[model samples]
Target: MIINCGPLTGFTQARYVIHMSTGKRLVLFRLPSIDPTSSKPNEKEGWSYYAMEAECPHAGGPMADSLIDIEDSAYVASCPWHAYDFNVETGESSVGIKACTYPIDVRGDNVMLEFPAEDGLNVALSKIEPVSEKVKLKNARPSETPTAKQEDSGMARYLDDDATLCDWAVHILNTAHPEHKIELTTHLFAIFTEREASSSPMEIGRGTVTAPDQPPREKMLTVNPGAMPRTGRGGTLKSRIAMLHALANIELWAIDLAIDICVRFATFQTEKSSEQLPRAYFHDWLKVASDEAKHFSLLRTRLEEMGSHFGALPVHHSLWLSAQETAYDLRARISIIALVHEARGLDVNPMTIQKFRLSGDAESVEALEVIHHDEITHVTTGHRWLTWICNQEGTDPVQVFRSNVQKHFRGPLRGPFNEEARLEAGMDKRYYEEMPNVVAAS
Candidate 1:
């Protein structure tokens, strides 16, 4: 049986997945231009194509987001989840495993894949429905720039000049679906980055926005902290999955927290201060929101691979509760959410990574490593902004951070801390070393 994947023009270095009715999946990839002296196959000497199973053999990692590169005269795709490389043509891996490959033929402008004929084979292409065409915002200021056309996911909602960064923040905050929230968060960040790189003016209308008290979450089970299940040391598969689900939930809330601080306090001006926050402040938090979205995506994918998923287990409302306590003060928000909660992550992530390592779950380890690296920069961003705000107020940032934690945070800081990572993020030991050392509630 043959299936027409799509036009060759639609293909790039990015991997695309093709689903078959036989419950099998194939990923299509376009090879880059290869050198003439390379030992590639004749049909694959120049720009070519190949199809392989969409799931990585290692941990069922999604290959559609794999990183493609040329190595040893061969095109290789590295699985995004664990960085396992596979030869595009042969599906051969250096780790003694092989992904199933299929035959492909390009006819004119179309790319086709061949599969074994079966008694009840179906090759109908899955239809992609479009997202809502436009999101109307009340009191939106008209701009000269026309709204960009909505594509596969209707990501064009905020591309026009009239939609302020605060507008986008509120939109994301109000989204209830997890996948849609992730998509919107990512697209908002991409649009912001593109505009910045081109030196285009991005409207950030402060004092005209009001973020939701709490972001909308769909059907997620929440329980008190004491009611949460024990995920013991990640020594068992169930325990590891529970740990990942908990982390995923945290990252989801973190995405909201990052974006929330942007618009929720967009109008904030300390006493004796007249200026609102600079654009760079919004940029930093948008990047943080984007990173949190990515971390949540990784953890969710890992959970599915392990036969469980987010929302499968009850989560604690402690994270969002903290967000609420600090909602009235930007300094308190930054102090508790970033400096305290995120800094606590910096302390605990290494041990979490080690737990996955001990269990031989390399895929989970790789995902956690990426989160750990990005979180260091997140803590750094929090510190940088906190200091900037304190400088404006003519107060010591350390004093302010300590004050906010003592006021808004529920319990004392605990340690067996990762001091090195904390220092690297500009969080000095003085920030927490002298804080009350009472044992934290479970």
Candidate 2:
């Protein structure tokens, strides 16, 4: 039996699972040739196609989702569950197990997989089906599907067909109560990470969900940046509380920003785009949102400890204003928010910590230090994705970043920068050192 998977170009995902009518499963891989220009005499020039069983021989891990990489000039797919490496061409594994391999032929641009006539199969690619209904191909090991009892627990809310990752993101953005938003954020992050580690992973639905123009909020007064009350130096208790409240407000907006990007620009992950993002993109932003929630919780707790709270002070709408400006462009959003605003946090964090230290507020100092360390990673995540997008477009990252910032940002770039943290986050001097309108520190 011969099955035509599709055109070679349609395999945007490196690996695709094909379900057979006989209940067997096979994974097709379109690997990169070590030497695209050279091949053995009478063989194809680009020799990089393979087909193998979908189950890992050791434990029934999802081989289709294996991590693909090059080892010793050969393609290798490491099982997600056990890290067992298998050669794509020969199916030879490090643990002395040999997986079944099949013949794959390319006629023109169409990829064809052949099987014995005895094993009849249907003609359907799993990629076109809903993720929840995909066939489960496992070895003789016990199935990892959740039991009825487990499905009835708290995590069941996220396991439903309609409650996709994007759906949860929209739900979080619409939630107005600060504590409830934090609770939902924590639950969604936990569920996603837990399912990803299990045999059954969470589904990231189509990127068609539209984020709200502005996140829901209540009670907390919003004012222009110039009109917001000043948070004086952290020497006195009143000033310290004010500073914490301000920081908490930023963290709250940050949570929305992170989740909003996941849903708002999700279509970029599809094959329709030239630079397709993998599922890892959603994972990264959800992780960022989770960290922001933690930061907000810490600041809120600290405020209550000093007889204050987050909503006690008014905050400027400037942060969300930036979000609105870059709502349609992912590049601009990353450039202005992560590289500009969040990077600024790294610059001022040391001074903020020092102030808390001098005022004998060690707890506040500790909290700021924790936030400072995590902010560096958050900035790094943004830089990494921005660079990936630029590489796909075959453009210089520095030029793209500068262009985006100049197009979306209104004010001059300020100095007295934290050169060390920015460097650690992969922002080189070329990206910001010699801006056209840089304002030196006074």
Candidate 3:
């Protein structure tokens, strides 16, 4: 069973420990310690006698609203109030880390923590907590910008396409370089205007841009032209080999954007006050980047079996387009890519799997399942960051999300929107419940 402590409540032996199953993880605590207790007691309140695990590593403030950094197996917690970091394992100040850390110990299947005892200023403290030193981290720098080297990754290539009509759709979908994204997009416009297919680089599409802001003028592109692989390859291994190649190519592209969005933009720039994103965010994003590459490789292999290759069918480029449009705005970027598009993947993936299964292609289905599961986590990340951005701006995240969706996307958000997936992805309850109400055009 899982026991979640109050957001502001710190480690109290009774309030903190939970008996988790093997391989299970719990949300041990929300905020680290807002009501820090240091040798204080209150019999009337029935509890007392505890101190903060560590000072706000950011600037010796209280650690509040934080989560343990399970990714590194390090004893650290992320401060929710200001994103100040700390090291719980050593009780040392992870102040420069710019995120909060909390102390925790797991004994066998049980997790234990020492709750800080609260002082008598309960009512007075509640009002002051938000504005207190605990809530503010000092001298944090802005988030790290992507370095020049990173600008040359596979994903970066995809982002460099020009913004033309037919080619626009292609650029959106193509796993080209980032710097080339604008040029690719520009080519799209020229291609559409030319009508006649040019000897242009592998761009496949209708030569037109429909909605100035929407997507491919023609929504129905399928797997055919890009099919028919080169002969003289291997046997069953050929497909697998091809898949690996495509996966590697696409993955490099996918992870680059994931890292930029999750770490640099969301975690560092938007979520943390001191402007330093949690190091854990970097690790997490890299892992995701690797996983996405694996998924793409796996799927590419499956496609090869059907005499098709990665570029056979025209894949919509909206996914990256959304990422591109919101490049400057992490919140908007996550909202579109992670939340909206990834969420859509939750729904669409099952159908893809079903199609593969019906075709007796179990291998393809398995690859898709891997993507489906991982996509959920990706969506969850988006949800967390989006919520954080909303909180930072002090606006109703859901409302802001709605307006952004209207402003950004073209086709209405279809329902069959994987409601179950959305909940698991950390979409707010109200948003999930009211999803049907957010009608996309028919």
Give the TM-score of each candidate.
0.65, 0.64, 0.45
| Residue 318 displacement (Å), model 2 | 1.0
Candidate 2 accuracy as lDDT: 0.75
Select the stronger candidate by TM-score from 2 and 3.
2
Using lDDT as the measure, the top candidate is 1
Model 3, range 249-310, lDDT digits (tens) per residue? 44434644553443235323544444444434433443444456456545555555666655
lDDT of 1 by residue, 280-368 (tens): 78877887888898888889889988999778998887899888888888999899999999999999999999999999999999889
Candidate 1 vs candidate 2: which has greater lDDT?
Answer: 1
Better-scoring candidate (TM-score), 1 or 2: 1
Compute the lDDT of residue 204 as modeled in candidate 2. 77
Best by TM-score: 1
What is candidate 2's lDDT per residue for 1-442, written digit by digit as tens? 6777677667654466777766678887765556767653212445467888888887676676565656677777866444578987789988899887777877777777776654443444444211111111111112254323443333222234447898888889988877757766766776786566445777776665778999989698888889978889998999999999989999999999999988888877322347567776787778778788878888888888899877988887789989998997888888989888998898899999999999999989877887887787788778877887876777787898888777777766678899888876778788787677633232
lDDT of 1 at 399: 94
Model 1 earns a TM-score of 0.65
Look at candidate 2 and give me any clashing residue pairs: 21-121
